[model samples]
Target: MPTALTAAYILHTLFAGVWVGAVLLATWKVVPLAKGGDLGPDALRSIESGLTTLTRLAAVVFVATGGHMAATVYGSEGLFGTGRGHLVLTMLTLWFVMTALVEVGGRRMRSALDVGKVRTAARDADAFLKAASVAGLVLLVIGGYLAGPAV
Candidate 1:
């Protein structure tokens, strides 16, 4: 049981970290560099491709591991009645919103690129992703605070 719990915990943390890191990189570095022409179209495309894949994978992991932990570990928190439960619920809500933003932005980017609207798509996607990044960052801070050592 302990081993299983440990594995789940590690996977959860790993994916969360990846999600945050990818968003931070996209929000801080990729956006500015790409906009200023410091990064080429190919580079921007490549970065977007990779980050989108990673973020999607991380979301899947988060859902699975988070659900599992919530069921097995924090199941007794009163399911949104208590403070911890409320925090978890809030994090989950933010996660859903972030996921939707990424999905919509990704689809828009793909459609724009298909129509040769590369610049427009990139700009639009950047805005959407930046919003998602901020949402993820807020979720990260809240989750960390909720799961702090003191907790």
Candidate 2:
């Protein structure tokens, strides 16, 4: 049977995959629409709504699974004990903060979209995407480290 830590690792890996996938999907779909030509008020609003919904769902899954994984893996000592632990904790912190910002920005964009304010919504969405991308990259690095042999 898998240990708690092993289970946590699997859960964390799944959450990270979903989180990164959502961000990339939105970036691919929306960025081109924004750049290709003006998406206009209606199309942009629709895009914003769809992205906001997708992001919120992804965030919920990430937070729930990640919290459980963190508790199992880090426990009382936190993720700061050894070098690997410290690196994991630092990366997690960065991703958490960035994800929070993305949530806030996503909410703002949703509101703007509701009002048919395409430009404002697009701006907020852009900010959210950028932050999410950075978070994803950090997560990827942390995952790579976790997969490597212990020193």
Candidate 3:
């Protein structure tokens, strides 16, 4: 493979790592603390802001590098045809869904939080966030499997 393609692959991997890692950390550490009353509303809001920044930055990098890599390597048919391609497509779809969930949920949570109703909006949505986290892990596992010597 060309040096440029290799670099793109590495970047794409790193961006995915950023996204998946942030989500996992939020689900495991932050969310639980907020839900368990260890963190107050202001703390949760601070976390939300920081997480939002990371999520948006990672999303841009992930999409740009992933699109470039997919186009350079497999193009359209390969993306839609093969098993590995299917995993990529699934990741893209799940990424979209999770992003939308975060965007919408964040907005709603922020609105409620603005009115001092943090627990209802944020903690209640932990279930959805948990599911998204599990889906993220699944995506990582599939990507790792595809990255094996077979592919």
Candidate 4:
């Protein structure tokens, strides 16, 4: 592989890890704390802000690097017809789903947190965040499948 493409792959992998890890952390840890009133409004808002920023950054990087890889490796004709192309498409769909989930959930949580309703914020955001977490995990699985057998 070319150096540029290799670099793209490396960046793509790193961002994917970060993005998914954040989602999982929010779902498994942050939400529970908020629901239990263990976290303050300021802290929750900060976390939500951080997650939003990370999600936005990851989305841009994923689109740029994934698009470059698809164009370079699959080309126009290969994307629609190949198995790998289909996996890429699946990943793209999941990416959108995860992003949207986070945005919607974060907005809901933030609004309630602004009012000092920690439990309400957690309740409102819980389902969306959980779904996003599941989608993120699925994306990783699909990514591994696309990677094929390791050498």
Candidate 5:
């Protein structure tokens, strides 16, 4: 059980980091480049495709590992009755927000790209991507706080 819990934590943290990093990069670098005409539509589409894949993969991993850890650490009681539990709940909410943002942003970008509208796609997706980036950072901070020695 200990080993399994450890593994779960490792996976959860790693996937979260990867997701957040990708969002940050896309929000800060990719979108700007695309908007500025520095990045071609083909390249932007490729990046968006890769980001979508990573986002979906990370979301699945996060849910599985997070559920296991929550079940193990808090049992049923730890869900809503404690401070850590609140943080976990918050993280879960942010996770959903990030996932939705990615989905919507990807859809917007893909549709525009499909029509050969590169700048329009970038403009449409930028806000959602930026919001997701902020949410991802907050999730990481809360996760770190929850992982303190008290746990």
Candidate 6:
């Protein structure tokens, strides 16, 4: 049977992949399409809807799996036990904050988009998405370190 830590690692990796993959798709494909005028109003609306759906889904997975991983790895001692635990805690906290920001900012952007305020919504949404991407990358690095062979 897999150890708790092993299970946690697997769950964390899965959520991290989802988060990172979504961010990459948005940045490398979606944004460029929007910029090149290939994504007009209807297209933008559709994209925004898709983004909102995916982000929310990913955030749910992130939070649930993250909490489970933390509990499994750290137990009641929490994250103060070791260097690796500390790194994981930090990354998790950052992910939570960034996810909250994205939720709020994305909602605002959607509202703005609904009112035909394309430019403003696009700007804010882009900023939120970028922040999310950065946070996701940081978490990925920290998670990789944690999963690496212990020093």
Q: TM-score of every model?
A: 0.85, 0.73, 0.87, 0.95, 0.96, 0.80
Candidate 1 has its poorest 10 consecutive residues by lDDT at: 112-121
- Per residue, candidate 3 scores C-alpha lDDT tens digits across 9-83 of 888778777777877787788877766767778988887787778778878887788888789877899999888
Q: Name the regions of candidate 6 deviating beyond 4 angstroms.
A: 1-8
CA error at residue 29 for candidate 4, angstroms: 0.5
Q: Which stretches of candidate 5 lie above 4 Å from their native place?
A: none
Q: Over the full model, what C-alpha lDDT does candidate 4 score relative to the true structure? A: 0.92
lDDT of each: 0.77, 0.69, 0.76, 0.92, 0.92, 0.72
Q: Record all residue pairs in model 4 with backbone atoms less than 3 Å apart, i.e. clashing.
A: none
The residue ranges of model 3 lying beyond 4 angstroms of the native Cα positions read: none
For residue 138, model 6's alpha carbon misses the true position, in angstroms, by: 0.6
Q: Which has the higher lDDT value, candidate number 3 or candidate number 4?
A: 4
In model 4, the runs with Cα more than 4 Å from the true position are: 149-151
After the best TM-score superposition of candidate 6, give how far the Cα of residue 7 lies from its true spot, in angstroms: 4.8
Instruction: Report clashes for each candidate as comma-separated counts.
Output: 0, 0, 0, 0, 0, 0
State residue 73's C-alpha deviation in candidate 6, in Å: 1.9
Those runs of model 2 whose alpha carbons end farther than 4 Å from true positions after fitting are 1-5, 35-75
Model 4 per-residue lDDT tens digits across residues 1-151: 6698899889999999999999999999999999999998888899999999999999899989999998988887778887778788889998999999999999999889878898999989999999999999999998888777623
How do the residues 1-151 of candidate 1 rate in per-residue lDDT, one tens digit apiece? 4676678778998888788788778777876765565666666667778877987888788878888888876785555567788888888899888888877777766666567555666677787888898888898898789667635
The alpha-carbon RMSD values of the candidates against the true structure, listed in the order shown, are 2.3, 3.1, 2.1, 1.9, 1.4, 2.5
Tens digits of per-residue lDDT, candidate 5, 80-146, equal 8888888889899999999999889999999999999988999999999999999999999998888
Better of 2 and 6 by lDDT: 6
Give the least accurate 10-residue stretch of model 6, judged by summed lDDT.
31-40
lDDT score for residue 138 of model 6: 84
Best by TM-score: 5
List model 6 lDDT by residue over 1-151, tens digit each: 9976666667668867876777667756776666565666677777667766776887777677777877776765657788777887798698787677667656866787778766666666777777777887887888787777879
